[model samples]
Target: MSALTKQSAEEWTQLFDERYKRTAWPYGSAVWGKKEWVCPDLRNESVVSMDEGGSNLFWAERFGRELGMNDLWVKLCGNSHTGSFKDLGMTVLVSVVRQIIADGGTIRAVACASTGDTSASLAAYAAAGGIPAIVLLPRGKVSTAQLLQPIANGALVLALDTDFDGCMAVVQRLSLDEGIYLANSMNSLRLEGQKTVAIEIVQQLDWNVPDVVIIPGGNLGNVSALGAGFEMMASLGLIKKQPQIVVAQAEAANPLFRAYQRDWHFEPIEANPTQASAIQIGNPVSVRKAIRTLERHQGIVEQASESELADAAARADRTGMYNCPHTGVALAALIKLRKRGLIDARSRVVVVSTASGLKFTDFKLGYHEQRLPEVNALHTNAPVELPNDYDSVRRAIDTHSGWNP
Candidate 1:
C-alpha cells in the first residue's frame, strides 16, 4: 500500500545536485567521453549473443503508442544468456574486474551468497574467467537447477551450514579480508553490469521511454542499478524521457515497503522462507541505494501475496512464459498494482520474468499435474527413482531404459 509516485517524480533535481561530485566510472562527462582502454573481446560475442539491447532506445515512441502507454515503452532486460536479468550486470562487472586484474590489480578469490539466480549467474561468469568461486549457499533452500549450477560449471560450491543470511554474513566478513571479493548484489560492479539492461532495453526499443518500468526489489541493488542506467540514459540524451520505475517484493520480506510506509528507522525482516526465495532477504545489503533509487523516481515497492505469485505463475504458463516462483511474485505485484489503480490499462506494463521455471521443484503448473498427482508420482518426471539409495535409482533407470548409468 506504500507508494512514492510523487517523490520519485521530483528526485532528479536532487540527483542533479549530487552528480557534480561523483567519481564512479559510469558517471560524469569526463568518463562518458573518454575512450575506454579495455578493448572488449568481440570474439566472446561468438559464445554469447550480440543482441541489440540499446538500439531499442530508438523505438520508444513506437512501443509506447503500440502498447497504449503514454510516452512509455518497456525496455526489457530479462532476456539474456542467463534467464534472470542479472547477466547484464555480471558481464560488465567481470569485464571491469578482469581488466583491473590484468592491469596489476590484485585480488584473491571471488565469493557470493546465492539465492538461486544470482549465484547461478555469478557462478557461470566466474567459471568462464577460471576464477575459483567460494560459493556460500544455504542448505536446502535453493532450487535444484540453482544448486547444480556451480557443480555443472566447475566451481567450488560449498553448502553452508545455515540460511541465506548466514552465508551473507560470511561473505561480508570476507569482503574486508582482502582475500576474497564479495560478488553479491551489493557489489557496485554488479550494479554496473546490471545497468546495461536499461541501456539495451532503450536501445532495442529505439530509445523511446516507457511510462513505467517495474523491477523486482530484493537486496535493492537490481532496481537501483536499473534506475541509475535510466538516469545515465537521460543525461546522455539517449532519450528525452525516462520511465517511472515501480518495484515489487514479497509481502513476507518487504523491509523497503514497510520502511517506506512507516517513514522511520528501518527494521527489516529477521528471517523468511517466502516462495520468492530470490527476494527472501531479511536485510537488503543495498538498503540505502534501493530506497533512494525509488525515492528519487517516485517509485514504490508493492508487496504481493504468495497466492498472487501462484496466480501469476498460472498466467505466465497461459502466456507460454515459464518462470520460477520469484518471477511469479513480480507478476503478482504487477497485478496488485494494476488492481489498485497504481497501474492501469492506459499504462503499458512490462513484467520481468526472472528465471526458468525448471529450477523450482515445489511450485506446480496445473498442466504438469492436472489432478494433483500423487507426490510419489510427482517426482516421476526426474527420470530416475530410488528405494532410498543410488543403487535403487540405478536399478530403476536400468528397468526403465534397459541401460546403466
Candidate 2:
C-alpha cells in the first residue's frame, strides 16, 4: 500500500467522532483510536497494546519566552510505556505479526535493527504477544539503560561490531526469509502507527493545526510518518492547512541535512559518534520518502553541533524538562529558525521529543559535570560536596545562598 490514502471529509469526520467517543482497550489507544484510518482489517484479539499514546503536549512557557516565541509546545513522546516514541509503532507491528502467525502464517520470529529505543519497544511488545523477538544492535554504541531493556524483555539481542547502518544491512538480509518478519520502520505498517503522533497532536489542540512541526531525524521514517499524518488530515478536511515540517539532525551524523544543503544530491558520509546515539545513522533507509515529504511540505533540514545540542538540552532541562539529547538537536534547530525569522514569534510550533532523558542518564550526568567534550555547559547545576562536619555543611549552604559567612 502507499504511504497513505485520501479519505472523504465526511468519512473522516464520522471516524473522528467515533474515535473520540471510544473507551475500549485497543481503541482507547491514541494510535489505535483512528483504527479505520490506520488499519481496520485486523481483529481486536490480534492487537497487542500497553495502552500506549495520548502523550502530553506541554506548553514550554519559559523556554518559548526565552526564544521570543509565545506559542511553543513540546510533544512528550518519551512519556509512553517504553519511554520512547517507538512504542507508538512497535505495538502495531508486533500485533499485526502475531495476527498473521495466528492465521497459520509461516513466520517464526519478528526481528529488527535498532539503536536503542526501537529494540526496547519491540522487545516489550513482542514479549507481550508471546512472540520471539530478535534484535541487532551496534556494540557499545547504545547506552546501558537502552541495552538493558531488550535483555530484560527476553529478546535475543545480538551486539555487532559495526555502526547502526551495518546492523540495518544484516537485519534486512535476514528478514528476506519468510520465517523472519521484519519489524523495522522500513515496513510501512510501523510508519502507519508512528504517524499517529501527528494525529494525536491535532486532537490535543481541539483539531487545530500548528504552524510548524520540528522532529529529530534518524532513519528518516519519522519525517515521512509525520507528513503522512498531516496529509491524511488535510485530505479528510480534518485540518485546513499543513504545517511547515522541519527535520533536525546532529552535526556529527547528518546525512539528510547534507543532502538538503546540496539541493538533494550527495554521497553518504561516515557517521560520527554523537551523544544522541539513536540518530547516529550514516545512511538512512527512508531517505527517498523523507525527501518526498520535505518537498511536499517545503520542509527545512537543520544541523545542531555537539555543544549546541548539549547546551540546548541543558537549558531545556532547567525548565523542569529532562529532554533527551535527540530533543536538544531539534530544539537547537528551532532556536536557529526563530533567530533567523524563519519561524516567527507568533507562530504555533510543536517540537517532538523522541525519547526520555532517563535512557541517556550518562549523557545528562556528563553534561552537568562539565565532562563531555566540546559541549558548553551553559547552565551547569552541579551538586556541592561537603565534609562530614556540621560547621562545614552550614558554611557551604551559607556560601551558596549568598549569606556572609
Candidate 3:
C-alpha cells in the first residue's frame, strides 16, 4: 500500500492505462489489470480469470431522452463469462483458494448460498481453477438459466426447500468446518475483485466521476464494493469528487429501503416474491457495510414494486436494451427520482446493470405476453398473429405498425 502511494497519481494512472493496453496473459483481464491494487501478493499462476471486467459502459441515449436526461449510461456488468457482475468477484475468490491449496492449505472445496449469480460465478471460476465448488440455492426461486450454470460447471448443487436467508444460514454453519471455505460476499476476498468495477468505470470515462451511480441491491455487498473503489481512488487522488450512490431494490425484499425510510434503523423482514428474484433477500449479510457506504456516499435507498419494475424494464427494452428485472428496479428508482426532481436532467448518471436479460427469459416472455401478475405490461410487444399467407402477414404488420403500403 505504501509503495503504491509513493507514486504520483499521474504515474499510477499512466501505469494503469498502459497495463490495460497490454495483451499479456493476466493483464488482458480487467480485474487482474489492476492486480497491484486488488491483490498484489497473489501470484500470477494462482489467478483464476476468464478475462472478466471491461464490460461496456453503454450510452443510454434513447432511454435517457425518455427520462429528460442527456447523460444517462448503463454499465453492462452482466456481459461476462457467467452473465452477471458476480464474475468480477468470483475470479478473485477462486484464485485465492487455489493459492492457499498450492501453499499446502487444507481447503477441500469452496461453497456459497446464492440467489443465483454468485453460485454461477463461483462454480465457473472454481472449475477453471480445478477446485471443487458447492452451491446451496433456494429451490424454485432462481431462473432456469441461472440454475443451470453451476450444474453445467460440475458444482455440487444443493436445492434446499428454503428461502435465500435459510440457505445462507445453513452455508454459514457448513463453513464452520475448516475444509469448506465460504465464498459469499461476507468473505471480503470477493470484494477485492468486485471493487475493480468502479475503477473500470472511471477509466472508461477518462477518469471522470459521474454525478450519480445507481445499482440494484440484493445481499448488499456490491454497494460497499462500489464504495470501496471510489474511496480508494479518492485516497490515492485518482478522483477528486465522489458520486452520490443509490441502492435500488425490489419493494418485496427491501429491508435497506425500509431502513433508509426509518432514518437508518434496520430490521430484517421475511421477503415477498418479486420478478427481481435475484435480490429477494430478507436478511442481507453485508447490511452494516452497506450502511457505512451509504452514509459515506450520501446514499439513497429506493425500491420498485413488481409492476413498476416490469414496466420500467420493458420500457427500456423498447429503447433497444434488454434489461433484467433487477435492472428494472434501478431504472424505476431513477424514474421516480427524476420525477421528484432529485436528479438533474443534465447530470451524468450511471446505472449498473448487474445481469444479462437473457437469464430472465421467463420474466421477459411473461411481460410481453401480459401474463405477469400485478404488471400492466405497458410496453408489451406481442407478436401479431396471422394466417400462413403473405397477404395476411403483410396486412397484419401494416395494421399493427400503422404503415400504409
Please report the candidate that would top TM-score against the real structure. 3
Query: Scored by Cα lDDT, where does model 1 land?
Result: 0.61
**lDDT, model 3:** 0.94
Query: At residue 310, what lDDT does model 2 achieve?
Result: 92
lDDT of 3 by residue, 1-405 (tens): 677899888988888888883689798899999998999999999999999998999899999998999999999999999999999998999999999999999999999999999999999999999999999999999999999999999999999999999999999999999999999999898999999999999999999999999999999999999999999999998999999999999999999999999999999999999999999998999999999999999899999999999999988988889999999999999999999998999999999999999999999999989999988877887777767899998877667862211
Query: lDDT (CA) for every model shown?
Result: 0.61, 0.90, 0.94
**Per-residue lDDT for 57-159 in model 1, tens only?**
2223432343344543323344444556666556555545555566676766777887767777777777776566778888888867778877787767888
Q: Which is the leading candidate under lDDT?
A: 3
Minimum summed lDDT over a 10-residue window in model 2 is located at: 1-10
Give the worst 10-residue stretch by lDDT in candidate 3.
396-405
TM-score, prediction 3: 0.98
The 10-residue segment of model 1 with minimum total lDDT is 29-38
Give me the overall lDDT of model 2. 0.90
CA displacement after TM-score superposition, residue 107 of candidate 2 (Å)? 1.0
- How high is each candidate's TM-score? 0.73, 0.95, 0.98
Where model 3 places Cα greater than 4 Å from the true spot, the runs are 402-405
Question: Pairs clashing in candidate 2?
Answer: none
